[model samples]
Target: MNNIADRYLLHAAFPLSMDNESKSTTEMICIANKKSVQEQQLLQALESSEQRYEIATKITNDGLWEWNLNSNQINYSSRWKSMLGCSNQEIKNSPVEWFARVHQADIEKLRRNLSACGQGDVSQFEMEYSLLHQDGNYRVMSCKCMAIRGTEGKIDRLVGCQTDITRHKQTEARLNYDINYDRLTRLPNRQLFIKNLQELSQIESSCLFGVLCLDLDRFKYINHNFGHQTGDCLLVKIVQKLKSCLRSGDLLARIGGDEFAILLAGFERADYPAEIASQIQQKFSAPIEVENRSILITTSIGIAPLTNINDLEHQESSYSLIEALQNAEIAMHQAKNKGKACSVVFESAAYLQSIAKFKSENELRAAIELEQFELHYQPIIKLADRQLVGFEALVRWQHPDKGMVAPGDFIPLAESTGLIIPIGWWVLRSACAQMVLWQQDRPKSKLAFISVNIAGKQFSQPYAGDIIAQILTETGLDPRCLKLEITESEIIENVNVVLSTAEKLKKLGVQLSMDDFGTGYSSLSYLHCLPVDTLKIDRSFVENIESNIHELELVKTIIKLAQVFNLDVVAEGIEREQQCDRLLELQCEYGQGYLFSKPLSLAEANNLLESVNN
Candidate 1:
């Protein structure tokens, strides 16, 4: 090993410019000495090369290291030790001390990679791992290592470089958090929930998982009345409570505003799931005091147990948690329909039945669009005059298969699906057309108005006013022949729109009436402002008109109140002669019910109108 020179290849050389002079100076030195002039010159050149290499390394903050595997020793570069918040003299220079500072969790992985390097296996010498700083904080380091093998094909020495990457690692972690979590609720969002669910399903062996679909009932009412800030505060409170109800292993997710979902497992019996759901439902039975106001809240829950992840067969290629959640949603709606503050379980057969009902609705909609619906007008006669003065337009669905379905069966469905808009429009047009025809046949008959009921959604549409005006104009019937009836409950929700539309209809010369009075939300302020021409006392009040003297007096009081407002009074559902006679005796201007005739078709109503004049 005497006078060992650098044994390396250098094919190209360029002049180094120093002091404004191009000199053929040596950029690198090679030490070669073997009793030859050339070898001795290389020895001096190699010695000078060391100073330039050290300068470049110091400028870039790059620490260099050499490990001698044969000696079982590891050496750390000065810069590497300095980057760890330490100086060269303050820390040991061996791999043992290096691993000592490494986080305990990452030590095994670092050891595994280092062992591969010792065996001459292909390994990325440069890597990143966390190290404990002098102050006990963690710092990330980027390491580069290259193997130096021996003549016997065994490792001899290894050299590497290390750089600090703590800032970069911190930035990456912050971005990952912002991407995966919800900002407002501070919970794992839909993205993170599905990811966690996927990971959990792979490891769990219980073969049982349940998805609970939780929707806040009347959450919209809170938002509407108290404003969105209060609504958000209430939602935060709800999220905390729902999170508390679940076990540590269970996952709670805020899937949407006013809606949450929970995945539960580790249950011994189906009753366990039911009991948990019941507990959540009952928790909100007490009022939540917010902003000095007591606000009552409740939840509708639908739960579906997943026997296999693929129990939901209708889902697309990547079977998702949302599909199971959707099944839970259908169950929740069923709970709501049965009445809120209850939990409903998923029944596959019953769910199929609901799907079938949905299909029937599509068919019913087609029947409505194709003019397959018919109007049945129930006569409202004067008990004393025995004359038909008006007819209540009852809508009937003439299904191709199920003929003449009554309003009692399909009307509620129509209202729920919002198909009532088109259906109500058809009813108004057809009823008005019939009234015009009836007047044509009996010129001397008492003038009768066709009363049509409007749905709440229909009244809310922006074009409702224009539609009514167009229908009356097209039918060539006096606007007086059409009486537009709206429920009291609907007017309370949208009073301004109701008042504007009612005034517009009145200006067009059509009459307005409030239907089903007193059974709904009791708000009398709308009654004064709604441009109503008649107040049809609901059928329930009329049912006990004779027996219940209180109801009898109430009916007389309604008529007396109407007289003061210059509004006519019509008593609905007058069945018995005594009820009709009582209404007439109370001086009620109009009476309608089964006693006159069950709702008749347009033809029967026309004939009844003919008899009025004869």
Candidate 2:
């Protein structure tokens, strides 16, 4: 038959009633009808497939496009046209039209990527780029493009899809902003400042760039006096003030806390940093008002000029931005020492001092290694009977080069360098071992206990209880006769960890004393919560108890608070006989100071103990 309609028919009269010629014609009709049904089914399946493809493109938010290589013609789907705020009729179906609409800056990259995909070197082309929209604004698009090869093994046509990704682009920009900026002050943070410093220091090697470190002096006082919210407000105002002092290209960043950093990217003279530091000093001369309160604050500035390194390897090593930052910090300390609101330039001597400090740190490590550290015992007397009840174990370092290095000089370095963990363990082990010896030597006399001062860093150590227990086991010291004097601030910081450790210490039968109680802002919560046996009055209060009424009252209040908590009180630094009488009158149970005798060496302590026993 000529067509499907002629090839088949759906119905015919009964075959038996028809003649031979008529029956053949009727059979042909039936075949034609069956073929027609199959043709209809195939057409329906093709329509279904086209509909599914349309749905997929819509669901994926894809804007599809096709190009004919031979004709140099282009076709765009409705979605593709809508994506760029263009009507189908507005945008011509030409390759030139599409290519021209790509962001001017992105066109060359788009061409390169498209060429790569068309060469069959890549399976597909993918990139995020902006496209000029009909609204005269750029819309970000994720373009996925590919080249389809013909049977002749050549590029037949180009195909691609575009997805609107403006929202994603915006999100990425926001994340980038958050990463580089400080939330509190809206200034470049440490990372961003450091990044810029690295770039400048590397490129402008011959140029002098002043790296200034700015720290608000007595900023902690603001936090304690006005609250952190007020402190935050002060920081914002401080940034504004510093930003005013900077040039457009100069960077001012809030590294953290009340600390800020400034980079003077270019300076005509070497003394410009010192000049800038002076200007800053003058700028902060006036008191700043924050949250309805006029807060008096002074800033200390340290300046270090970047050193030049020509070699690439040395650029990365010898002249690191971090080294410049450290130098600035060293200068800042000198400024602080000079006075608040003062500015100091980095001196060569500061570098030498840092070298000395590093040497001291190494010597500390050596001291710990060579067992050059010693424990001196100061007597803790029972004021009621003048009987020696306990001794405070103080760590002393016998440095080979520096002679006797005081703990005040080295303990801070250990804490800063995280050497306190190992050093602290040694102190604990040494104290425990000494206590064991004292107990063994004086079997008749009742040596109640020895108190070892634990640093804030040491108390923060994980598994503090385990360390203490191990030392006790090894030294054979009775846990009952060992008291750990920890600062009250340590008890309040990190409540969960402190609580767990405190509980473990209690279980281990170790007495806990809150050391330097009145010096820190004491919270009643700590006094009520911690398993403390005693409170040692800070020497600052006890040193001037008679002279300063406020200090005297503070001491009395502390004693009363300890009494309410059922904790014993020990007044430290009691040198005068009058101070001892005053402590007795105040019902203070214990006193430790030079009056009882200075911290004695091990042999001297043993002799003193023998004398007391006799």
Each prediction's RMSD over C-alphas, in Å, is 9.4, 13.5
Candidate number with greatest lDDT: 2
Global lDDT of each model? 0.78, 0.82
Predicted candidate 1 versus true structure: per-residue lDDT over 50-130, tens digit per residue: 667667666778767777786676676667777777887887657787889898887888787777887778544667888
- Kindly report the root-mean-square deviation of model 1 from the true structure over all alpha carbons: 9.4
- In the range 173-213, model 2's lDDT, one tens digit per residue, is 89999999988888889999888876765564655567899
| Steric overlap count per candidate | 10, 5
Off by over 4 Å in 2: 1-48, 86-92, 115-124, 134-136, 307-319, 355-372, 375-614
Candidate 2: pairs in clash: 7-32, 8-32, 8-33, 9-29, 9-33
TM-score attained by model 1: 0.62
Q: Best candidate, TM-score-wise? A: 1
What's the CA RMSD of model 2 in angstroms? 13.5
